[model samples]
Target: MPTDTVRYGMISTAKIGINAHIPAAVKSHNSEIVAICSRFDGPAKQAAEENGIGRWYGSYEELLADPDIDAVVNPLPNSMHHEWTIKAAEAGKHILCEKPIAVTMDEVREMTAAAEANGVLLVEAFTHRLNPHMRRARQLVGEGAVGDVRHFEAVLAFTSRDTSTDVRLKPELAGGGLWDAGCYSVSAARFILGGEPVRAAGFAADSGNYGVDTSFSGLLEFPGGAIAHMRSSVEQPGTNMGEVIGTKGKIRIPHLFEEDTPLVITNADGEERVETFAGEPRFVVQFNDFSECVLTGKAPEFPPEDGLANTAAVLALYASASSGQITAVERV
Candidate 1:
């Protein structure tokens, strides 16, 4: 705990944990993956060995009980997020949880309460928001480059590589395009808008007869006459992009989640320019940010409250999709 780097114990060998968090932690200057835990012994050991981590545990309890691990990286399934995150917080270790923080608002609140009670830091891993280009795009909006936000467009769509065993397609695991991919679009919108949405309306499609939604188009009405249109799908693969349309100008964000996607700004006078950013990967930025907060004992730049609001917004949209009615987002 006295060192400059945070020793992170990854909670699962899920794709996010293995594909993103582990690599990012290894690349980060302020964070290191000292250990990884999975209920399965083979995966935990394999991932640890493959990633050059020092230790691996078959059970989460054993990993959490270790005194060497300073924090936990939780990329568990959406439904399991609440339980595992609360457990980590209760164990007095900081947590970096994946997006769509929990299945319901109550669960997010409960997890937040547990972290607060235990005096541990809990951060939601929003890769889109942490993307450097997205940060610059937000700055441009704040500087009036977009000129009075009017409407926003965002989409994250992809066809499932394997529908047979992918956990993202299973309803019991809270799998859906909206929860899996749409959350990024939702987060991008809220990040740029800097305001909580008041109303939400959505329509979901269950292609391939998957029993759960495979694609969805959602609408969020924010204050001051600004609105955001978000689309996400696992059945339709296309460009994942964003655009901020304002009264006087518009910014075209090609691929909002990518690391080096250029931002095109078109002003009212028909001037166009492309801006690119140079920095670490989105995942790396996220890990280092979390580690910085842990080391400095400062509140995270985007705290659990932001996660609560984002989850509330996504839930409102999903609710509207199910009921075929306009749902009101909880004002957080």
Candidate 2:
């Protein structure tokens, strides 16, 4: 291994690891997938052979014990995040875990505690926040480009393939439209408004069929009097976009969580302008940033602590959905 380059053990042959991170690792100079692991030997061996990884293990423990690996990328199902992430931390490996970090506030605390105890870097994979589009949007809101942001709308919807077996549709896995997609909207609202919501109201547009939400809508009220209406779906098709409306203007994000997107701002006088960024995959950028953080000990702009607020707000919304009333955000 080259000095300062982070060697990763890719956990599971999950489609996301193969389709997104593998390609991203190829493009990253300081990051490499040195190994891969699955619960069975055959799949691990096949994935390793096909991907050109030098090492493959049948168990996560074996993968973690490999001295050649410096970190792990855990893209397991939502419910598995807390378990495997803590395991990776205990093994003295830094981690870049999938979004919605954990399903509950207690799990978030436990994961954070384990990482801090082990002196490992643990980051939630909200890669879009690392993109320039979101960075600039947050800046614009702060600079009054969207004067006194009063209202916002965010939506992320897509049709899933093989819903019967897809991990996203399983309730026991902590899967649902809100956990899979709406977390982005809630996080975006927090990012753009630069404040946490005081209260949240959620309504399940679709539920009971799968014991999880297929489509859902949520309303959040921020401390600064900003209101956000967000919708997410796993069984329907819709645009991935966000709009922040202010007293004097509004800013729009077309691809809310994708790296290759632009920001469109409209002023009180009806003038509009679009802000564009060069094309790049947010995941690739995230892969490289993980290495940078490992080697240089620099904190990510959106660190794991930031994810706590995100998970808390989502939990509040989930509680609201269940109780049939607006609920106060836990911390507020």
Q: Estimate each model's TM-score.
A: 0.97, 0.96
Residue-level lDDT of model 2, residues 1-332, one tens digit each, is 45778999998998989888888998898899999999999999999999889999999889989888899999999999999999999999999998889999889999999999999999998766777888898999999987887899989999888888988899899999999999988988898788989899999865548888989899999977899998999988776888899999988888876776888989999999988887567888898888898998898777778889999899989999999999999882
Which residue pairs come into collision in candidate 2? none
| Candidate number with greatest TM-score | 1
Best by lDDT: 1
Query: Candidate 2, overall lDDT?
Result: 0.89
**Residue ranges of candidate 1 with Cα displaced over 4 Å:** none
Cα lDDT, all candidates: 0.89, 0.89
